[model samples]
Target: MEIKEAIALIHAEGLQAGTWADLGCGEGLFSVALAHLLPPGSTILAIDQQPVKPLPYSIPAGISVMRQQADFSLTNFQLPALQGIVMANSLHYITDKPNLIKRLAQSLTDDGTFIIVEYETTQANPWVPYPITLQALTELFREAGFTNTIKLGERNSVYRSGKMYAARISR
Candidate 1:
């Protein structure tokens, strides 16, 4: 199926996360959006190795945005007890992808889900992320410890130009 079609399949199921997270959140778009995806009173933890950047300052009230400057590759720091969703967009920027995800997966509750969005290799942008195709999103999540994974379909990714793809993985 088309990449966008695949991602749409994932997002359409809707977000059931109570406490969500977006690891490696660069600009915070995916993190912010996922925060909005949750039911009211839900919290989202937006963790990044980079220092927090200036966002609109004005954000949704219920969402608890947590920023982490520590390197996620290190097996240090406290993982959150999350019963919601976690997302990763364009993870190719990660130097230690496996370790980084192992830490992230450790945070997932049995009821939680992990959403990943990456570009289809053929359509990946050459300037960003060394242009690695986001198609291996499933394998990456499996390596991270997601036992139950399903192709959630693709959508025209706002994350990039060509096509925005998405996948849903869970414990």
Candidate 2:
């Protein structure tokens, strides 16, 4: 699913973020949306290992989309406390999640929540490492310090794909 739809889903669940970071943001769709949807004086930090191109949409004054072309490794990131950290459709690409999640928890503000929206990879080859089960993902995050796990919704009933999931991790 697109980042806009993901952000829309977050909004439907009544999560209003004053400061949003599109962590591992590829092109900045959700970052742009957060900039637009958030209340006045809010900011959206669109960070990625690659720089996002100039968006088709204009960035509002309050939004600060920092295009960081640095790596996403935990050792590389020096995250300051942020309101919301979004891991949208990019979890599988991350090599080491446990350490990353711990860093994320530490980087979050007192009232912050980490949001992870990922694709439902079907169970297939056991020896392969591409797809991981929902339970596995939850356990990984829980082990990393996330407590609340919930299945948010299905992306759509197509190709028997797994449902979209979101978890809230308190700092």
Candidate 3:
């Protein structure tokens, strides 16, 4: 998807500028979008196991981006307390969703935001090995101690038959 579409998926009002981590930030598309939503002086930790290319879109000034080449799915992985976390099209790669969500919840500051962009289907394909439908996602986050899971937006997928949804989770 394009940068504008990515931004629309997760945009919300009253978002403050703070440190945000984009796990599995492939190409930094959603990372750039998150940066735009936050106020200036925010920092985005664009992380993936592979090297992330330079951001394709221009972020607001003073929004710094730090790219980290690490596997975020690992249980032993360490992360600082963050105001927000974005996982776009990345959670499907993980086989154990509950533990991963619980671990990530611990990484967030109180009143933190967890944004997920995923396909709204249960059928797994070669690309999506462990798909989490919206219903399953809500249950998973609820089990992880989150109190709310609000769907921000959805769009028809150009590549897949199912729709892509973006949801904001909170404690």
Candidate 4:
């Protein structure tokens, strides 16, 4: 997706300038979008299992991104308490969503946000092995103790799999 589209998908009001993590960041597409909206002095930790390219866009001043190669689904991986987490096109790869969500919630500070961009479909292909729709996403996060959720935006998928939706969840 384009940077403007990415930003529109996950942007929300009242985002504080602080540390955020993009799990399964790939090449930091969504990370760069988040950086655009974040206030100066924010930092992003972009984690992916494979090597990632340097983010393509020019990031905002005072914002930094640290890339790390790691499996974000692994329970043993450590992260500092963060202001937010972005799981753009990444959560579906995991088979155990509940456990991963619970573990990730622990990595967030109180009032932390979780921004998710996902295909709103039940059918899964090789690329999205365990997909969850927006309804399922709300239930999943609620079950994991997240208290609030709001749909941010939606777009037709370029891959033609289905419509894509973005949601913000918070505790």
Candidate 5:
């Protein structure tokens, strides 16, 4: 989905402000978009395994953006306590999804939200190491102690003809 659509969906979900993170933020598009959606003075940590280039758009006032280079799949990596986290088109690359999800959950505040955008198919490929269906994702989050999960939005995948879904999981 487009960044605007994703931002609109996040706004509709009552996400007004907080310390947000965009894990595996490739070009920082969503990270920038989120900065605009959040309340003033909120911070966004845009992290990626590879170095991320500077954002193309103008940052809104009272928002701080921090760029970090780290491999999230590594067990030694640490995450700060956050009010919200977004993993868009990135979780599929991890081989151990359950562990990562659990670790991410632990890093969140009590009422924190986790947003994910992923393929809806169960098929696996080289690029998608751990293809997880929507049902499976919900189950995984439930197993990880997330009590509330919502399907925020869905659209046809630009990489393929299949469908993709954006979900929100909260503790």
Candidate 6:
């Protein structure tokens, strides 16, 4: 999806002004988009295991973007209290899914939201280690203590010609 469209989808999920995180933020596409969408004084933690270089483009003033390199699978990795977290096309990489979800839940505030954009296929490949359908994702999040889960948007996956969905889960 386009960056503007993705930002709109996130906004539709009732995102509030506060700290947010873009876990496994590759190239900072959504991270930069979110920085633009969020209100002034909001902070976005753009994290990935790989080092992130400075953006070629400019970011507006009053929005803090902290890029970090850390393996999220390790329990030692720290995440600040967040109002929302976006895991766009990233969850499939982690071998320990439940543990990561639990840790993400612990990092969120009471009213925090977890937004996920993933493929809607059950097939797994080398690139997609743990492909999960939307139903499975909702059940996983539900088991992790999120009471509400909503579908924000969907689109055709260019790589596999399957479907990709964006979901919002809340405590």
Using all chains and alpha carbons, the TM-scores for the candidates as numbered come to 0.70, 0.75, 0.97, 0.97, 0.91, 0.91
28-125 per-residue lDDT for model 5 (tens digits): 87787778777887899999989767877677999999989988878888888888898888989987899998888778888888888889998887
On residues 34-128, what C-alpha lDDT tens digit does candidate 3 reach at each position?
98899888899999999767777788888999989999988789999899999999999999989888888898988899999999998899989
Clashes of each: 12, 0, 0, 0, 0, 0
The alpha-carbon deviation from the true structure for residue 78 of candidate 2, after best TM-score superposition, in angstroms, is 1.0
Model 4 gets an lDDT of 0.92
Candidate 2's displacement at residue 149, Å, is 2.3
Ten residues in sequence with the least summed lDDT for candidate 6: 6-15
- The Cα error of candidate 2 at residue 82, in Å, is 0.9
Estimate the overall C-alpha local distance difference test score of candidate 5: 0.83
Residue 158 alpha-carbon offset, candidate 1, angstroms: 8.1
lDDT per residue as tens, model 1, 1-171:
332333234453656647776766666666666655566687767777788876543456766777656545466766668765444554656656677677766677867777776666654344455333554666766666677666655556554557655666776
Which 10 consecutive positions of candidate 3 have the poorest summed lDDT? 51-60
Supply candidate 4's per-residue lDDT for 2: 89
Better model by lDDT: candidate 2 vs candidate 4: 4
Write down the lDDT that model 1 would get: 0.62
- 4 or 5, which is superior by TM-score? 4
Task: Compute the lDDT of residue 67 as modeled in candidate 1.
Answer: 65
lDDT of 2 by residue, 96-167 (tens): 777777776777776676666665665543322345456777888778666666665445524445555555
Q: How do these models rank on TM-score, best leading?
A: 4, 3, 5, 6, 2, 1
Residue 13 CA displacement from its true place in model 3, Å: 1.5
lDDT of 4 at 19: 95
Best by lDDT: 4
Sort every candidate by lDDT, greatest first. Answer: 4, 3, 6, 5, 2, 1
lDDT at residue 40 of model 3 (Cα atoms): 86
Shift of residue 124 alpha carbon in model 1, Å? 8.4
